[model samples]
Target: LGITFDNKLHLSGHINNITYKAFRTLNAIKRKFRHQDNDTFLTLYKAKIRPTLQCASPVWTPHLKNQ
Candidate 1:
């Protein structure tokens, strides 16, 4: 994450990093199995990617609707 001189918080970089890591994890899973059903992929995504995406949400979650 980036913090500007004006105290502005930029989370896009942090989110992008998380996305990259998650994709790497997913790609590794894909390489592990030659053939998998939709359910298996779904389970893998939920177990691996979802946790990374959903973690520490309260810290960044905006309280105001407009945010």
Candidate 2:
């Protein structure tokens, strides 16, 4: 669950399995890393595929704010 920023039209995808196991894992991570920094991800599914489908991000990003 990191950050992402992209704008294009190519292929498409789907999240066919939004199961409780996923939620439990995410919740566990959130709790475990509660005392850490604000912008952190305990586990990322894909290090390269995540950043290809996002728009408004941290809002504090300098370049994104300019747009």
Candidate 3:
């Protein structure tokens, strides 16, 4: 999935309740995306993933203690 606003693009990987690894990867803090890539925002946040007409909700990524 993807979200766009004011010419900004936010990319979301595959989302499935049974398989959260894909989406989880996006939620990872250390998981940096390639803004230069043609994909999307460079979404570095969790909730950024938008729901599709099909069926899929976003989940929060567990954060570590340290920054």
Q: Identify the superior model by TM-score, candidate 1 or candidate 3.
A: 1
| Candidate 2 displacement at residue 20 in angstroms | 0.3
Residue 27 in candidate 1, Cα distance off native in Å: 0.7
Query: Which tens-of-lDDT digit does each residue in 1-67 have in candidate 3?
Result: 3322233322222223423643665555345654434334444332343322223333323233421
Best by TM-score: 1
Off by over 4 Å in 2: 1-18, 36-39, 42-67
Give one digit per residue, the lDDT tens place, for model 2 in 1-67: 4332345521111121223335555666667667765445623423222332222224323343323
Q: What does candidate 1's lDDT look like per residue over 1-67, in tens digits?
A: 3311223665555566666888899889999965999999999889988887777766655455544
| Candidate 2 TM-score over all chains jointly | 0.31
Best by lDDT: 1
Instruction: Assess every candidate by TM-score.
Output: 0.69, 0.31, 0.21
- The reply for model 1, stretches above 4 Å from the true place, is 1-7, 61-67
> Candidate 2: what lDDT?
0.37
Worst 10 residues of 1 by lDDT: 1-10
Error of 1 at 39 (Å): 1.4
What is residue 39's positional error in candidate 3, in angstroms?
6.2
Question: How many steric clashes between backbone atoms does each model show?
Answer: 0, 0, 2
